[model samples]
Target chain A: MLRLCSENIHSFFASESPDEHEPPMPRSLTSANMTGRAPGHTTGKERILTSAMLLFARTPYSDTSLRDIATAAGVDVAYVHRAFGSKAEIFRQALLTLGPLDDIAAGEPDGATMISRICDLAFLRNPNRVEDVRPLHLLIQSSLCGEARAIIAQFIDSSLALPLSRAFGHADAGKAHFALSLLSGFVTHRAVLGPADLLAIPEAVQQRMLQTALMNAMLDRSDPGIQGQIN
Target chain B: MLRLCSENIHSFFASESPDEHEPPMPRSLTSANMTGRAPGHTTGKERILTSAMLLFARTPYSDTSLRDIATAAGVDVAYVHRAFGSKAEIFRQALLTLGPLDDIAAGEPDGATMISRICDLAFLRNPNRVEDVRPLHLLIQSSLCGEARAIIAQFIDSSLALPLSRAFGHADAGKAHFALSLLSGFVTHRAVLGPADLLAIPEAVQQRMLQTALMNAMLDRSDPGIQGQIN
Candidate 1:
């Protein structure tokens, strides 16, 4: 409860940083290099977030812990609590470094561009971009716990939903909100759930379906019968 | 691990029951009414599941304990442990009483019937059917924990997904799987997450939008422009 109030209080002063409005830099440069410390050094919080991003990617939220984050970050566990409050708070901070929300579907005029941006986050098996997708991976992995879902919901509400809503340029935020919600569902369904036949589709065709389905979600006002549109 | 294998072994002997193929009854008739043991005299396991279903609906998985379930069901905690193995296993058992997979979006020839089946599950606040939606509520509530998600995924694969796939009568199960995936995402998005403006849209209009968008997910082959086709 204190954590929730404190965060609200801080954000009141933290004017939406100009950095957020700027297109996100390549993640590698953004995370460690731009800590504004000595180039080789990271703030203890940054290191903890970096370690957390990794450990969370590898395990479920239940299995990952402050001790694990501290061990990975080479910091004291007490310091992690003092600074971050709880695992969920650390997760929120980590979500901040996960590039721009616009990188996923916001600000894209077309489906092809949208897919290109997010392929790194959830769909593709790009080893180099694995870090970019860990937040999503962790979301899917931790989706079964109430607290984790609450934190994620809070993050989406306060952070992800509005930017995408604004980026969609709709007076009504419903389109972007529903679209992203649908996207998360598609990812969860395909990644962890069954009906193995979906995996059997040629990856290329599935990508087309994903693009088309999402576009439909955004513009749900479409006539229902006209089918077979691909970006 | 032992629980998993035991389940698999039992399912192998348990030929698909005729009860599965029959259309599901209303929620009131399905859960306690058809326990097959007796009308008012539910078995200890049934009572335990009954309590679990209610308790899990109210709290997250981590917060809902074996002791809580025992107290609610009027049984000893040891019985819950001995019978259910763990909280997750009990959850799995409770998921079974959640009517049928077809109750969501399956076997129906059109979108109108599809909506009716599931309006009871997650979309409506139909108080009489609150018990029916408990499985989805629990799935959403516990979605933040890895163990909980794993079990849900397992349950989805083993029980829910294929039935819907078969019901859709598609040689390709991708459509059904993807549709259900999209549905869960929508529910999670609108319910737990935000873009609160959506709630402002009259509920009746929201229902129509849901039906249209879900149909689109199942039929992603549509020309992107043919929009606004409501079921």
Candidate 2:
């Protein structure tokens, strides 16, 4: 239901500048400079975040540690703290590294094209960066039981819900939420479900289903009489 | 994508029978009490699982601990281990308690009403059961990164892809997988994205989109246009 500009969406997918080839790393923490401090380099924080993102994506959060991130980034533990107050802060930054929100904001007005473009971009981006996404999942799981749940929920709410609502022209909040929910569900299912299971559904049929859902949400704004009925 | 029986779908929305009114505990586990464990005498393991499920649903998985589950279930640490062996197993059993799969499986054929009934059933079930669903989400997240991911993937395969393929009489593995993916995406979206998002698009429009896609898939069988196009 979010209204994205086609150009923006296209940019997200196509505008892969060479700099974006690899995630931003903390250059200051490179092996050559093993010392905790990075003189006059803002990238010190970026490096910590990049390392955290990689680890979170590949490993479960519970299994990952601050030490592991520090070692991987070639930075001292204290430096990590100085750059980002906590693992959570590092994670928050790492997630935003993809810059979906900024992308959406920059590309607007061409809502229909934008939505499709964004989807294509996401599909291409392999949103599931094991080091980053995996830990985020762990954090999400932890939020359900731990004190951090609120923070995680807030992140999801803002990152997903806020931008989505704005894109959809501030239409019915409930409906926008539902649309977002459906999109998230699809992405999650794709990531979690196996190739075998995925292979079960015919490619043609899958494509049709996805196309139909997206088109309907984007193009057909009128009531079609089958809304609640079709499920 | 999956073919659910009408009766089962109906039952999912209907309240429990008056005679069956008891705690939310699964009957299978409760009835397992033997000479040592009485009908009312819940095992420490069961308690741990129950507590874990509640916590998992309400909290995120990473935040939860054996200690939290034990404390809530009124059991000790050892008991938690004696019963499920690990946090993963406990989480798995807790999900089985929700009975979504069982409910879907139990539905009888009623082609005209099946889809609507299934959707209704899903919508009727509260997605806010944080305690119940949180662990499941954790399991799903963890599975993406570990061995258990395969198991979870298989479960999804059997529950959604297999049944739908059988119903459609499609031998083509790829086709079936695609269909399952779409359905899974839809369901996930509904659950995670709030109703608000769904309600954004006119109800009629949503219905038409779904109907078009479903009808096209059924009729064409081969070419459901727009393989990668956004619906």
Candidate 3:
């Protein structure tokens, strides 16, 4: 895929100011953005990105075109084309900005810790990501273009699957890929289908089953069921 | 939730001729359409529908306009609006046309049978249905319009979840809904992510784990793991 190569790619996904209503400070560090900045402060590119991410989050990619993003950002379409390169590039940035996976990756890289953290997040809320700017929903709603698929696949393979496989020494890549895919499916199901009532089983049991499934898949444990089977 | 209410709703989903390329015959029974027909023959509405279904299958719903369908169907835009009522309605019709779930429901409707049939279909092919017309892909690609969501949720509730709950007498509806949601996730993951190399574990063990996850979810079995635990 041709690179979009935003001139400020390094700062393109910097943390937003606590003001929350303003466009994110694309050029500044998080500590600088968070402290003593007025709520109205922003740059043109930050404005464009905020509008683009919000619009992309709210509507399917097919529904929100370059023109729409520009209109929402108060810029013209040509500027958007020049700056973001393509809608797919804009989406890739939004996903990086919104996802928690980076946080997990930046923390402990243990296989069980990774699986348990994801499971904890999965059931902790009801219809959680559907109403928000979530990476899972963003990826789900985006059109399956080569650029976008390649971007997501590369991210998952590098971020989640690779770390997971390394955590289980000498584990072939296939099991890690399958484990992440199943976990993705589990999350996608909730994000796309919205919420259903809680299952008849105790919530703890449900979480254990999910955690066990992922661990068993990820670690290739010989245990017939859960890698950490409930006693 | 106004329906486009095509008068031939029953026949709208009738099985197509194995001839494979022509518009399905709307007026005749499937046996007749399969037995004998000139390769090019089709009804005006059938031609319109065939065009609409193919376009919807190929492109995300937001990108494919009613005018686009009209052009492909060789009809005026007004005629499409007159016939299908709206883009969402057209997609609803298209989903019903492509789905295999109706076939399962039309068969014995056994609980494990329903779950296994879907699982088998999920893994039996590689990157299956991403390149072709499929109900799951259509739903995923379609914008999350209220009418489309309602149509799908209603169908799942009536066809799969309800019957599944019934299979295990005294079961709560919550368990069945959760079970189907997870299964939907499993299928959705495969459809959207394309494919990966098979898991390092034996295929049989993977299937057993998946089956156990779903059966345990659906039946609310008290056993710690796989309702039918592997020996």
Candidate 4:
């Protein structure tokens, strides 16, 4: 059973053809180059984030320690501390590296457009950009437990709320927040609860349905009446 | 600062009169003298679940321990063990008590209705069913790690997929999995992620937008040729 499961997982990954849809990773940021500190001040920070992201993708946050992250990044513990004030800060920064909300905000034309763009950005960045999507899942699972909840809650609030409200004309902060909540929920669900076919359903179908639902939500929000009612 | 925050939290909880839309607990099953348990079966299991739910709601899963739950439930460790085989099992069963998906499934008219009903049910349950809503945020926060990821992933797969697929009538199991992922994401996001002001975008607005989007998606599935072609 284990062998079969392994073979199936291998086939699934093989079928995905990483090159086709995988987001580009900066050469400097790749796991392979994340080690051996450079003379630049922020290089160590970047390396730490890269290593942390990779490890985070594979392990739960509780299981991951600053020392472990430092080892993975080939940096000293002191260097890790200098770069990020704490584990929470490092994890937050690492998540930001996946794709910053600021970039999504900058691309939108209006509140409605912003919502669509944000959803698209989240979907695109999530499955593809993060090396393994698994660590993101682990982080969320950990949030269900301790001090991590506050950090996770704050990260989500800022990532989705601040920029989303800005795009929604500030007056419609409520609407923007609601929209953000919906979008994040969708993205997190996919990130954590997916690879659905092994236990539930196939992957392609799930993607299509999600894209459809998201597009629908976007189009509905575009209507002036709908936006007015929400505001 | 902590005291201030606690005071504010207390004020918020105290001021908010219980809304009519609270979720129905399996009170009929777990009430003090319910018929569900075998005679002489100590109500320790139910108490453990109650404590677990409360702690899991306030604290992240990792930070919460079996001992904490035992202490809160006012039961011996041995009682907890007799009731739940493990902490994960306790968490899982506690969440299940919030509402069974099967209960929702039994009430739907068809696949489309199933989605609508589930959404409505989740919305209604979210405010009332603190147990269900609490774990959602925690789970999302923890998804960044490993063992937690596995546990949550399995729960999503087992608990959400099959029932959602049956409701959707998608011939392909993969499609069903995707549908559930999308739904779960939407619900969780709505339940947690943002401030009440942001979330309070008027129920009418939410309903209209969600219904329109849902209908559009359904139509697209019913007639693939018109997919993306329609506004």
Candidate 5:
């Protein structure tokens, strides 16, 4: 029975059909660096990562299993274990395939430019035309978990908070933390909440709303109302 | 086999020990109004609703079964089916118990007052001591699903957007939407992401951060750069 299930999974991946069973391979996985080899040789690993990314994006880590990823990728459960070592490793590798976070870690960021870059990395469709790049979505959900949560917190502190603190010469990095909060809030809304309703509002108006929120959050303007009573 | 499983489920809920097996009865369920009578008279339905809420909060709809709720509530599967009619109805009723959305639909809202109310309804620890209210968490997860997503979206529109439009005297209710965005973001971060790490920051600093974000999002102050460009 297990062998039968494994074969079914393998066939599903090899066919690469845009079926209900498989999330079609994302464009990012097709890139040279992400796949790490020619498509002919790394097809199995590539397919597994693509499926892993899709599942992780929408589902919480605790609920997702190696078998589920393997089944989605059309491979055996053993194949998944052999390839990725563990579920955590699969998730971490999947996250790395999403666009770079280096810019957030170092250098000065312009308000408009930073907003555009963050939005693009988050909302831009992969080459396969899939929207809501799954790894970023998964990262938000992963924040609730253990090791993954620690990794994400560290990433935010090192990549975002520290850079913003240095960029504007503020002794405090609260602005960067707020900036992350704004970006995270926007993306979470965009992904989990169906964007169809938001689309009813004029696109320009909504974009301006986000831009304003991001700028305000990134700049350290204190409100007197919350000062002394905050603690 | 199924009967044996059902019996085991019944024992689990009936014992009602503070084991991981059961989500302790929420105060809302214990209330005279919500459960339809005194606790002794309506233990079965109340337990079912409590179990349903916890399951629905974390598990996806399709993934959650009547059997699971029955098991968690210490009732027979038939009892759950007979009492609730369908899984969807049980979910809807569970949502109703969270508290009224009438305030969001129509009223003059003070931002701080409204924020406090929302935080209470969403984050309040039930008598059972579960800090994360399952329904709110489930609502966030439900956004990725179908009918549940529609219900949540309508709730936001009726409860939040319309009222905020009236409160602020803006023909556009986008501010209310933004306010919901901020609140949702905060709650999700608080619930799914552990608060222990955040506690490392000074209490005043974190509270000030949320207050500032809420204020900026609720007030429709367009940035100068994005002003003319906004539709």
Candidate 6:
């Protein structure tokens, strides 16, 4: 099952920038060198975070060592120790770099488009990395572990739930959390079930199911305006 | 990651019979010895198939040894070899014992009840094993492998799609498959997200969403009777 761990997290995440062909490997542990704006230039700390992300995504916590991350990042092992302090801390930072749920949370109230965007984020493959989405996959695969699960749950609460609720015209996190749960299930099912034939279903039907279910999960029925549209 | 393998395939499958306290260790595994069944007795081949199912469900194919299964089943390892020929064959046979699609395929047409039943199978846990359902969990965990994915896809086609189509009063497998895809997505979401608060969204609304979506996914506009009722 360790083989299920992806080696492509670095590629998947780095593919956002065209020139990041190689991982960020600092030549020296100087903050001045790290502060440069070149495409692949990363501070020693950023290098450790990205390296830790890639390594941790591919190997479970106990199997990964600080030395492995340092070597991958082309830095000294002691540099990694000084920057991240511990493997757990490195993992937390790695997930932190996935950016906030601001894309979902900060957007205006457009339930249909918002649902589609959420689905896209959860299920779409990055154009550059055909079959990899490291951070999402890492979170899903490691969700069975207590520590990773807690970290992810916390992230969802602060970044996803609160913002999603505000978008739906309610301050309650319950609706946002439920809507997210449904979306997560759908994504996970598609990945694990790999029911390719299901793709043959008309795109319209799929969209309808997704939009309707999401609206139902996220909004209250007290509003006749939304209720009428839903029916 | 290997630790994710279920240690309970034995318990999950064996819990079907109360008296199966000791694994079936055939004193003689010859064809003649394989024939008779006294109340609770099993043929050597049956024992091997069940044992393989339990073991394979717990551990990945490459990691599990015949010796481990034989020890668990209380049989000689060579007996497993003689009986099933190869690990691959044993795994296929184990899946086969999850039984034919007859239950789903042969049922009376009741879309509401059928949808409810399908949901139950996908989401419900065994009353005895509070947190696990070994075969489903095994399939999800091992789906990254080609063999398990193929077997599961085949099972879904036969068990889920075919019968569900029949229940919808048509022979179209498309509707059933689409509905199933949605249900599978929902189930996978709950398992991975662990969003317990989603349960707070009143049972009536949940049931309505399930039933309505399933009906929409499974029925065509050509059926005025069903369409009228759905509205």
Q: Interface RMSD values for the candidates, listed in order?
A: 10.7, 13.0, 11.5, 10.6, 9.9, 7.8
Off by over 4 Å in 4: A1-21, A24-183, A198-205, A221-231, B1-21, B24-27, B30-76, B79-102, B106-108, B111-113, B124-160, B168-173, B190-192, B195-197, B207-231
Kindly list the per-residue Cα lDDT of model 3 for residues B1-231, writing each as its tens digit.
111111211121222232443221122322222225565676656667667766654455555788998899899999989988988787776655554345444445556665555444344221122223345445544423333555666555665567667655544666666666666555544444433543345656656556655665564443334222311
For each candidate in the order shown, give its overall lDDT on alpha carbons: 0.56, 0.45, 0.52, 0.51, 0.55, 0.54
Worst 10-residue lDDT window, candidate 4 chain A: A1-10
Q: Per-residue alpha-carbon lDDT of model 5 for B90-198, expressed as tens digits?
A: 8777766553444332256655555444544433233243233444555654544454655666666665556555555564555666666766665555444333444
- Give the Å error, residue A22, model 5: 25
TM-score, one value per model: 0.68, 0.54, 0.58, 0.60, 0.65, 0.69
What level of docking quality does candidate 3 show?
incorrect
Cα lDDT tens digits, model 6, B34-89, are 35566357766776765665556555554566787788778998998998887667
Q: Would you list the clashing residue pairs of candidate 5? A: A9-A74, A10-A74, B104-B159
Model 2, CA-based lDDT: 0.45
What are the candidates' individual DockQ scores?
0.22, 0.18, 0.14, 0.20, 0.20, 0.19
Better of 1 and 5 by DockQ: 1
User: What fraction of the correct interface contacts does each predicted structure contain?
Assistant: 0.31, 0.28, 0.17, 0.27, 0.16, 0.24
Checking candidate 6 for backbone clashes, the offending pairs are: A185-B185, A185-B189
lDDT, candidate 2, at B160 = 45
Ranking by TM-score: 6, 1, 5, 4, 3, 2
Please tell me which model should have the higher DockQ, number 2 or number 3.
2
Worst 10 residues of 2 chain A by lDDT: A1-10
Where model 2 places Cα greater than 4 Å from the true spot, the runs are: A1-42, A60-64, A121-160, A165-170, A195-197, A200-211, A218-231, B1-112, B120-151, B165-231
Task: Give a tens-digit lDDT track for model 4, residues B35-123.
Answer: 36774574767677767776655444555678899999899988888778888787667656643545456555465565555445434
Q: Which candidate leads in lDDT?
A: 1
